[model samples]
Structure formats: structure tokens, C-alpha cells
Target: MAVLKKQLEDMRGIRYDIASLKGSISNLKTPTARQFVSPRQMMTNGKTPTKRSTPNPIGVGPSCISRKKPVRGNDPRKSAARTKARRRILQGKQISEDMMAALQMEDLKQLCSMHNVRYRGMPQARVALRKIPGLIVSDTEDLPNRSATGEEVQGANMEDAQSVESESEEEDDDSSEEAEYFEGPEASKDVQPSAH
Candidate 1:
């Protein structure tokens, strides 16, 4: 009789499980409806997804993806330094040799660039600094040692042309002297009494 009661209790437990399962099935969404929702939406329970403002993010959409980082022309710190140097120049305090000597090569370059002074091929920073003053004071557009006066350029070109001509003439004279030396000796030797 105890065994029979135990079997009845087991049967009741199985029946209760079946009823709970039916209730859960009724509350659950269909697979087709679940298929319509994105995995993100499903994970979020149909809530709006949050956006991250970082350059790289979890979701890689077309709009969010970038092949390369955006490039900035000038760094803020460098620009600030340039502005400070400019202000110092305006005050007529930083143009002194001692003040310029105190500045680093990079600082001098920034100063040159700020004033649009051409200093690309300058060998020394002091040389570049010297150009900045002429650029500021002179009304002329050209930088010192960059473009010469028209007459100066023409004179230089004429000098170069004359030197080349002189070099060519010297080479011609040397070649003629060598020809005479070689041919004269050979002809004299050939004219020697031929053994009959």
C-alpha cells in the first residue's frame, strides 16, 4: 500500500510539470517572430542600442568604420608655441641673439613657419632665425639668400658660361698638344732609314 501511494505522488508531479510547460509555451514568442529581430535587439530585449563615440567600436557599420584616422596639420601645442613666439617677436624682446640662442631648433622652425619664412634647406637654426627679421622688415616678397636680384642672377649665369667656355678651350689645347706629340714622334720613327 505504501508503494502504491508513492507511485500516485510521482504521477501527480509529472502532470504538474506538463501543465507548467504548456503555460511557458503560450507565453514564449514563435521562432518566426524571433527571426525578425536582430541578435543585438534580442539581447537587449527590443530596446534601442546605445552608440559609442570612440574611433573603434563593437559594431562595425559602414558609417562607423574608417580605414585611417583623420590627420591634423598642426598640433595645438605647437601652434600655441608658435603664437607665443610671434607675440615675443611683436614685443621686440625675442629677436636678440641671446634670446634666439636660448630657443631650440624646433622652436626656431615653428617661428619661421608662422611668419611664412622659407627655411626648408637651412643648415643651421640660427641662419633660419636671421631670415625671419628680413622677412618682417622688408617690403620685398623674396627671402634672403633664396632668390637673388635679376642682375645678380644674370651675372652669375654669365660667369658660369664663361668658365665653361674657358675649360673647353683648355681641354682643346691639351688634346691638340697631345696629338702633335704622339704623331710627330711616330712619323719621325716611321721615316727612319728603311732597311732595303
Candidate 2:
């Protein structure tokens, strides 16, 4: 009878365990009033809920390429510098050496970009600025000096032509006089010696 009683107790325990197991299984099938993390979200290695590592690595890793994002436009600061440089170019103003020296190398590069100047790498700003003025002067040698305008050049040319024409007329008069001197014998030949 004791053995039967012990068996009954074991059976009751087993029944209790089965009931608990059934309850847990049912709860797993459909969790009640719980936050749902989708399968895609769970696949993202969910260690930190707030912070995630960015795809852009620190510095340039081996696999990484250019850091400048294509989506965003050019750096505004550089574009501003380029606009300033372009304005100066359109005005035909010389870039002052003092300003060139004061500006950063990047700013000078922006200036060069405005004028379509290309370089292998970052060149010396001062040297490039100095070269620009000389280039302007050399290329524009055909243009008359600032003091000599179109009217002044026309006046000078007119005066030169007048002087040349006057000089030529004077030479022709002198040549006519010399011809008279050489024609003395001819003039005598034309006159009869005497009406003998």
C-alpha cells in the first residue's frame, strides 16, 4: 500500500510538471503584450540597443575609398572661396601678394580652380600667386600701355604719316632742282648757237 501511495505521489508530480510545461509552451507560441523585434532587426547582432557602429571607419581602412560623400554637394566654404576668386578674376584685379601669403593653401587652390588651373598636388600658394600676375602681364603685351589709349595711338600714327608725306614731298622738290643742274648741256643743245 505504501509503494502504491509513493507511485501515486510520483504520478501527481509528473502531472504537475506536464501542466507547467504546457503553460510555458502556450506562452511561447504567442507572447502577450510584448515588444516585437522583427526577424530583420534581430539579425543585426542586437547587443547595444542605442548605439550602432557606423559603416564609415576611422581614418581610411584598406577597403575604404574616398571620404567625400557624393550625395552632399561640394563643401560650402570651398565654394565660397571659389566664388570670391571668380569675382576677382572677372574684375581683372591682380591678386595681392600680401593677401596670397595670408591665405591658406586650400584657399589658393580654390582660387586656382576658379581660373581652371590644375596641379598634381597642393602647390605653394605664394609661388602660384606670383606666377599669376606675370602670366597676365606676358599674355597681354599686345594691349597698349594704360597711359596710351586708342585715341592717343591714332593721333600718333596720323602725325607720323603726315611727317612722312611732307618729307617725301621735300625730297621730290630737291630732286627736281638737281635734275635742272644736270640738264645744262641739254638746255644749251636746244638753243641755236647763233643765227649765222
User: What is candidate 2's TM-score against the reference?
Assistant: 0.22
| Per-residue lDDT of model 1, residues 5-119, tens digit only | 9999999999999999999999998776444655565434666577667675767676756586656865555556556555666654334343454455676676667666665
User: 78-152 in candidate 2: lDDT tens per residue?
Assistant: 556556545555566553333343455666676677666766655554455567643232222332223334342
lDDT of 1 at 6: 100
- Once model 2 is optimally superposed onto the true structure by TM-score, how far is the C-alpha of residue 13 displaced, in angstroms? 81
On lDDT, the candidate that comes out on top is: 1
TM-score of each: 0.21, 0.22
Model 2: runs farther than 4 Å from truth?
A: 1-92, 120-125, 134-196
Under the 3 Å rule for N, CA and C atoms, how many clashes does model 2 have?
Answer: 0
lDDT of each: 0.57, 0.57
